[model samples]
Target: MLKIQDIRELIKAIDQSSIEEFKYEQDGTKITMRKERKMIEQVQQVVQQAPISIPQQVVTTVQPQVENIVEKEVKQETPAVKPTNLHKITSPMVGTFYSSPSPDSAPYIKVGDQVKSDSVVCIVEAMKLMNEIEAEIKGEIVEILVENGQLVEYGQELFLVKPE
Candidate 1:
């Protein structure tokens, strides 16, 4: 039998890589993980009596005036400063963010702390595995965006770093 931690590590490895699905069987036990859940959900809906309706945000409209107004609002919200200069360390997958290796330990990095390209800044726990997140750039940490133990989405900015 595989240890719980070993299973967790396996799940984490599959989650991080480009592979979308994984399966394993040993001694009559089988485990499977699929990154794409939408296909599975659609299959489930077909089997069930109730069909799920997802509303589409896009609408066919003849009004150019409304489109212009929305475009203007979008342009105004995106400023041409600070954000472009800072390096964002984004989450690679959806998971729970952890600032430290364990609850009792000091956080991996804090604002103003120096980090190298290979420095481990934090951990993102997915499927029970603690996957260490690297800085991937030489920099000084500018901000820690997420709170400890918060659920984070894929590509969500977790930290801002001022690259050296």
Candidate 2:
């Protein structure tokens, strides 16, 4: 298994070299990383050269339409509004979420379950370590946002609670 320092060193080495992608596998663990610098550079080049090839009048006419389309896409991707009174319990690190301590066990908390601030709500496994996640707020669990064994990102909402 690669240590945290080793992973950081690998990232630095990849950044210094011209390699666009990297993959490493050891034991049962796998790591993959890629650089999108080339694609971004190409996009920037096209944008920089656009005004030179096109007439000013046509550019002015097309730019507004492009902006409108982008605006619409952004609006469509926005998530549904959350309730103002609910407190969100978010993941502290990127990891796999586990609802139960073991496969055969019941979940730590379920919908409508009342919990204290120090109550263990779930577990997030990162780098083969089982990290107990706390509620952090005295409340009733109103929702569970992720399923067992789901991959979760840092700051991603895992539960919504209604405060007592």
Candidate 3:
């Protein structure tokens, strides 16, 4: 029989791995694990339910009389610069981001802080469990892309790091 710790280790391995499904059986004791497709469907449903706000903001800010002038001025402004050497740290699963282990504790990382491969950079809370995310690469943190407590999707960019 599989112990609780063995099951937990299996789950962790599944979470960190690319495998979508797994099954095992020994003497009629069976175990099965699969990554749910419902997650993507739920995300799509939430997106559809949420109202689009960007167009409303633009409409409220720009007056009809000066719209043309403002459009030209906006077009002329320089676009935000994206660093070429920066590597994106993305979310491994859908969850809420926590910068610190606890509310009263200091954050795991900050902008300009150096990190090595295997360094725990933040925690993601999913289904009441806290999963610590590692840096996976040696780098200096250049930007934090999500706010604390923000819900992040699978593969969403969480931070930008300039590799050492």
What's the C-alpha lDDT at position 81 in model 1? 68
Give the Cα-based TM-score of candidate 3 against the true structure.
Answer: 0.53
What is the lDDT ranking, best to worst? 2, 3, 1
lDDT of 3: 0.82
Write model 2 residue lDDT over 1-164, tens digit each, in one string: 78866775786687688898999888999998665564645755675566546578877989988678658755655667867999999999877899999999999999999999999999999888999999999999989998788767678899999999
Model 1, range 14-95, lDDT digits (tens) per residue?
7688788788899998877666545644654564555434344443353575578657755754645665678999999777
**TM agreement with the true structure for every prediction:** 0.51, 0.55, 0.53
User: lDDT score, residue 64, model 1?
Assistant: 72
Residues 73-124, candidate 3, lDDT per residue (tens digit)? 4564435688898999999986779999999999999999999989999999
Q: Comparing candidate 1 with candidate 2, which one achieves the higher TM-score?
A: 2
- Cα displacement (angstroms), candidate 1, residue 96, comes to 0.2
TM-score of 1: 0.51
- lDDT against the true structure, per candidate, is 0.80, 0.84, 0.82
